[model samples]
Target: MVDADQTFVIVGGGLAGAKAAETLRAEGFNGRVILIGDEREHPYERPPLSKGYLLGKEERDSVFVHEAAWYAQHDVELHRGQTVTAIDRGARTVRLGDGTLIAYDKLLLATGAEPRRLDIPGTDLAGVHHLRRLAHSERLRHELKQLGRDNGHLVIAGAGWIGLEVASAARGYGAEVTIVEADPTPLHRVLGPELGQLFADLHTDHGVRFHFGARLTEIVGQDGMVLAVRTDDGEEHPAHAVLIAIGAAPRTALAENSGLALVDRADGGGVAVDESLRTSDPDIYAAGDIAAVHHPLFHTRLRVEHWANALNGGPAAARAMLGQRVSYDRVPYFFTDQYDLGMEYSGWAPPGSYDQVVVRGDTGKREFIAFWLKEGRVLAGMNVNVWDVTEPIQNLIRARTAVDTEALADPSVPLESLT
Candidate 1:
């Protein structure tokens, strides 16, 4: 049942692609493995780019998934600084930008996502930045340091995770930070008004200014350098540097060109995949940010763009490719570290999905576990400064059983006992 001649080609050299290759070897797949990526650096994790690395708490080497020699020793043919221009599904081959064609028996797409660009005028001006890649982080670190030394002002558009994290880092460097968000509260779409205000308060207490209910209209520049930013509210803030942290869009050009099915943009655009992470084309699979997987547990197609998904989804896809029975039902999880407040969120409860939010512990002290419950059933949970409760929290979501509201909000009630 095994063939050494079979070759598996993986497009994208991020954490998902790298882990898939590692899983293939660990699962005893003797077939040839070829990995292709456009970036010059070896495959690395993206979290550090915005977290430890940007904050100068982590070295450049710590971001990489494996040492440079690991791929060579593992017999994984890595193509760095190379792009897969097109996929010829009929011929089962992929064409590289250099015009090289490589055949494959099975193909995996882990192309990840790119930062959304600001469409306003003066985007090309110097000091206007977007943080999505390692190069961008490195450049932003230098800019933040310079801004800190001169007490320059940083104008950030969009109060999403990236925007808030960058603001925290800037504040750590003693730089002036002002965030302009169109939404009424920070992380409005994700956490809703109840908890979103918590984040807004946290930043305000740290000397960061917030311009809510406003959208950046244009980046005013002088001599091809950013001077200030004008918001839709007709307010112009002097800024030495500007950051656009709107969000990220999945890289689905290759999948689209190859005729792979894609999820609608409104429903969170991505490569449509089944529970096993298999694409419409039987020979092709998708994982990570690009895979909008039909989750058996949630009973809906969900595309999660988080570090945990890539860390686990890649190996799951790899096992599925090896003809192993697989079902990807991992609960959506993500965490954030901003200033002294660190938090972890498990499960999905997008606005309107939950009826009530119950909190345990002390919100005033910034140590609490907030649960989103629908009809007394836990849909999601977020622990701020609370540790060792992830398993119990995820278990509650998986159980899908109604819980007593008073008991749920009581700190003396152990989560494990409730589960």
Candidate 2:
């Protein structure tokens, strides 16, 4: 139960913030809760915007997380187009962009991630875009709409989830998309070789071009608009536009300015938070991609950009915000639907962490699953078309169940048979 006067202020109204607000109300908190989002429109689902929303299958209104009426009825103070300038934890006040201060007892930072940009010359050209926000999606939708040709060239930088999804959307939008990845295979880190190859084939079957081992030297534009991309191999392509979907780093400026401790990395600097999702400051908590949480499953601190993590982790932060002690130990599940292939993956397979991998399905039909096991225990698994097996395998991984190497290689034996 929440005290009537206690005000909970959540900064950044994305999936994490919106879900936190709704989850708080569902958890029986009737206190004054204010949700501040910089977006002009109400909170919307981002996953579809990269897939169905861009393909004209889903409408903007159909993808909204919640309507204004729903939020009003639940007693949430929804502030759109509002920016949080600074956080004064000592005073328990947050400064807005319009020079107003809002006081709160508990504060949640869902500051999300920003798109990784390319520093090439013609990157700022007209046709170069990054799929980060809803506005960006709308712009891309309009651009794809304008192209009268069925196979317009759209060059992408990375083959990560966003990059591939955008490629799929663009392909569905009647544009011929080409992915330029520095890595050998798509999703090399997460999906490993076998599963990533399946994804590559899936995209290739849809008439997508893969430029593996391609390094972009310059974004060559013509007449004030993107025209071509020059690679390190001294080759220029007839490109209509460039979509830089490399990846994203956590939005940690707020945490850094507040003198909150951060999970330092040699590569990416992410927010450092304790087990309760509380930041260095006890009164404040962090969630979503921004929060670098210590995971019990991986035995390490991690920052996940997965939709499931945002939907689940934000509510866990809300619970901790309400002074309820509960450990958030949900094993992360990630999924992506590209063309006819559906992919689902769970658990952590750090870079080169798995020595030997086991495959249980055939890659010929592209309808199989593979698992990454370390020392006879399952660490991670990826399903290409057979996603129904993720549940039983996820449980086996969760339970830390060990299996015989031959049994793992056997497809006839159900994954649950080992139990």
Candidate 3:
């Protein structure tokens, strides 16, 4: 057993940091482990924040992954409501939001990303919001609670995941929401053109208006309250509130300032990491949204920002820290709930990768599984309403199984047959 005095410091107590602490303890790491986070709340699952939690179907406590007693039992030190201000790589010390320094034997930076803000005029207005933290979701819930009597409109600035989820939440509150995307579709980068169009239709079915091919000119407001939004399409939309969910960039100032090597990605920007989730510095490891992980299947370094990523990557990183020599090799899984049904998508269905998509049910029927075929094998699959196939499809994709599309698309064929 490692010395109890040996300290393992984990920065950022989100899913990644919290999971790392749990794994270290489970691995018989009796050493002192500390988890630091900017948020005061115990580490909670974030996926429900937009769906069930924001929609008033779930309470705040339900979002929490573990309670206070769990951490107490595990002997994990969770320092919430604090920030990590700086890092001294030369001495292996981390500085907190306050002027305090802590030495560490191993440092794991699960420093998450912050939602990018729109730099238009009047963006500082009061009703303008972004969904990234629990506090932000709480504010949204408050605003939503007032929807029936007071709320009227919600302008979503980005068509990304958070933006779409916020839009869904607003719709759930009976607010007339409009999603203004600078891109053509909400999930243009993540999903290809056709699937993006399908999601656009999904939102439209729920009375959510989409302003595609739009560039936000300014956030028109008065007296610190947002009143309207002006777009480059020469249209002004009235709104009671606005959600800025454009995108998120990895928070890497502490790492870059500490002379860590950052990898530049071509698809825009992302942080770089090696196979073991280690940064340029051997002693420091990066996980969660902040690190660009080397994908074993894709043969690329991809930055993933899903709840599944945090849930899985954090443990894989912990194993690596324990000399288990494990790499984070797994297909990504993410889900979104529209008004009536849930859409769960797995893996990166890159453009031109899928030669054909076999639909298991009618696309217009509101429940179906579509398998992405690349050279006759299932590369990825997107499902709406039917969730039972998600696991089997993921398994097939990982095993690189060649699917019989003729049988898969048949109405009588069970999803288990593909496995």
Candidate 4:
């Protein structure tokens, strides 16, 4: 068992790692805590990278999880821009990029996911960007300002959350925007056809163009700068800048090299962990985007990438490190903001897991709560442009009682009374 006198090492200084270090101090652990990250900045939040930060409404300091002085006061060593090269599980040590070796009694691997890069030609062009870090957002912001001056077009490669959010931000800057997606509708896999159509319509109403069932074949460039994006059908869309938002893959290369077991990529790949976030090797734990956790609530192994999972997974891993028996059973939750719509969703039901969707408000008006039911049991619920209904929606999911579809669809019936 890890005690107060031993060193606890945390890899990847993102939200999950920072929160775990904070939890250790809050739980009365007086030992050394080292948080290592490859980036040159303190641990910060990523959701704002595409929203307020990219839009210039949020300042750089506001995105940080904690102030720089907080680490010093808490006695946690902040090692920025340092990469962990290897993990020696037998020796309980990690080797840094600069050949420094650090020993730890307990280690937490929070190495977060990386944005999936486009492999087509011209990916190395000057105006092509991927949104994952603060630096990426800063570059995109500068590019957007330049496009605003020229009234140029900004082409987004995918219609996912990042793609649509950036489209909204670019449109706000008075730039022509277009989104290309292979799916029939935006967010179709997660929200299904009917709801995905709503998002597609929302973007269209805001002056953003969409090309559905389109796949990028190559990015055309001139003098090492992006000029246009060419699709598979030999169609070229003019682009002053191109943002790739093709989703992300788990950062599991470090764990794999260290001989930790990982689930197959098809099965939500990452460092496989049980309910308490303990990896195959008991002394090490993983959380955030890098953990393929066995969720007790879903009864399936899944890896979540949203803000809520990282916020909750950090503290749970800390408790397990302290030799406390803990189970991670929190319902998976996430939210998205696009155009004039704001939504919060709770519970989990993968694509094809539910048979019916019951909506309480108006889908055409974009104000409603949609519930995905499997055999009358509420599997998931989402509130779009609706406020203060999250608890009631969550309670209905937790009750796991079969709900009547007609009652669920009736706007007069309160959601809390469903079960």
Best by lDDT: 1
Q: Write the per-residue lDDT of candidate 4 for residues 307-416, one digit (tens) a residue.
A: 88888898889888888898988878888888789999888876799999888889989999999999999999999999998888888888888998999999898887
Overlapping backbone residue pairs in candidate 3 total: 1
Cα lDDT of model 2 by residue, 1-419, tens digit: 77978999999888889999998998889889999998888987778778888778987888788877988899999999998989888999999999999999999999898898887778888988898888899888887765526456888999999889888877777887888998899998777775678778889999889998887778887798888898877777778888898888888888788888998755346778888899999989999988888877777787888888888888999999988996777777888888887878888876587777888777788677778888888888778788578778778788776778788778898888875
Clashes of each: 0, 0, 1, 0
Q: List the residue pairs that clash in candidate 4.
A: none
> Each candidate's TM vs. the true structure?
0.99, 0.96, 0.94, 0.98
lDDT of each: 0.95, 0.84, 0.82, 0.90
Q: List the candidates ranked by lDDT, beginning with the highest.
A: 1, 4, 2, 3
Best of the two (1, 3) by lDDT: 1
Compare candidates 2 and 4 on TM-score and give the better one: 4
- Candidate 1, 1-419: lDDT as tens digits: 34788999999999999999999999999989999999999999999888999999999999999999999999999999999999999999999999999999999999999999888998999999999899999999999999999999999999999999999999998899999999999999999999999999999999999999998999999999899999998999999999999999999999999999999999999999999999999999999999999999889999999999999999999999889999999999999999999999999999999999999999999999999999999999999999999999999999999998889899999998887
RMSD of 2: 1.6
**3 or 4, greater by TM-score:** 4
Q: Model 3 misses residue 237 by how many Å?
A: 0.8
Candidate 3 per-residue C-alpha lDDT over 341-411 given as tens digits, one digit per residue, 9 for 90 to 100: 68888877677767887878877867888777788787787888986777777886886767788998886
